[model samples]
Target: MIRLDVSRIKNVPGETLRLDLNFPMDPVQSQHGQVSFNSPLRLTGFLTNEGGKLKLTGCLEGEARIACGRCLDLFDLPLKAEMDEVYCSECREGQGPGGEWVLFRGDVLDVTAEVAKAVLSALPMKLLCREDCRGLCQRCGTNLNREACRCSTDDVDPRMEVLRKLLKDGN
Candidate 1:
């Protein structure tokens, strides 16, 4: 878990703290799929105490392994994300710096959940091995990028059969 010791910073406003560390994280499962980090993630950033609120700004750098959305092949994906979060010492439930806030009663602030969220948000909507990946042939389940398949490419949807017949009859 990534945590920041803010016992000193809480009493001193305008104070800044520097952070640079590497830590291992568990795989994150989402609606899309599972994502696992290749190695320890490097976190670099600073935290500043502005009045009674603590503002954390940092960058997370790492590599993640994910399955390709098109070809179903597992590949390495580079991860780099910038994060900015705010914590309040006396914030009530559902109140925060920008409509969302973390409440802390002690000097230590755990940021594991926040970091995980940042990683999730940084993921691409569609993971591809390459920009122009041809993907697999739907009919024959063949990798089109490697070679051509024997499946006929002229197959039409059942819903379009009526329209196709009308056009063929010149109607």
Candidate 2:
């Protein structure tokens, strides 16, 4: 959990603060699979007191380990998420435009959720170990990247039998 002390600038409007924060990030479960962070997440930018709200704008950077979508191999992935989240002192916890506000009470702002959301959204939908990664064979389950598969490659779909028959008849 990462918390920021905003008491100094809470009541002072138009006050700006430069922030450089680094903290470890937990493993995130994504649609593709589990993504575990190998390095600490770094948020570097400024926080300005905007009258009644605290606006935080920063760039997040980290390294993570995830599986290759095509070959199912584990590899290191670099992460960089741009964030501009608002911390509202007057609004309720769950009220915002598409979860835009990070509700805070007293003089502290908990930015863990917003950071996690930014990292999650920054992850690519398709992860690949290499550009030309040949996926595993369906029948024999062979890693084509390492070695050649002995599975038969001439098996045609039954639905395409009519096209083959028509070509053969024409010949």
In terms of TM-score, the best-performing candidate is 2
After superposing candidate 1 on the true structure, give the runs of residues whose Cα lies further than 4 Å from its correct spot: 145-149, 152-171
Q: Report the lDDT tens digits of candidate 1 across residue range 1-171.
A: 877788878879999889897988888886569988779988899988988788889999899888888777778889999989888888887875456877778889888888888888889887887777767776688887788886633676766766654653441
lDDT of 2 by residue, 1-171 (tens): 877888888888999878899998888878878988877889999889998789999998988789988779888888998999888888886788886677789988888888888888888877888777776765588887897777634676766666755653443
TM-score for each predicted model, relative to the true structure = 0.79, 0.81
Candidate 1 pairs with clashing backbones: none
Per-residue error for 166 in candidate 1, Å, reads 22
- For each of the candidates, the C-alpha root-mean-square deviation to the true structure, in angstroms, is 6.1, 6.1
Q: Among all windows of ten consecutive residues in candidate 1, which has the lowest summed lDDT?
A: 162-171
What's the lDDT for all of these models? 0.81, 0.82
Candidate 2, poorest ten consecutive residues by summed lDDT: 162-171
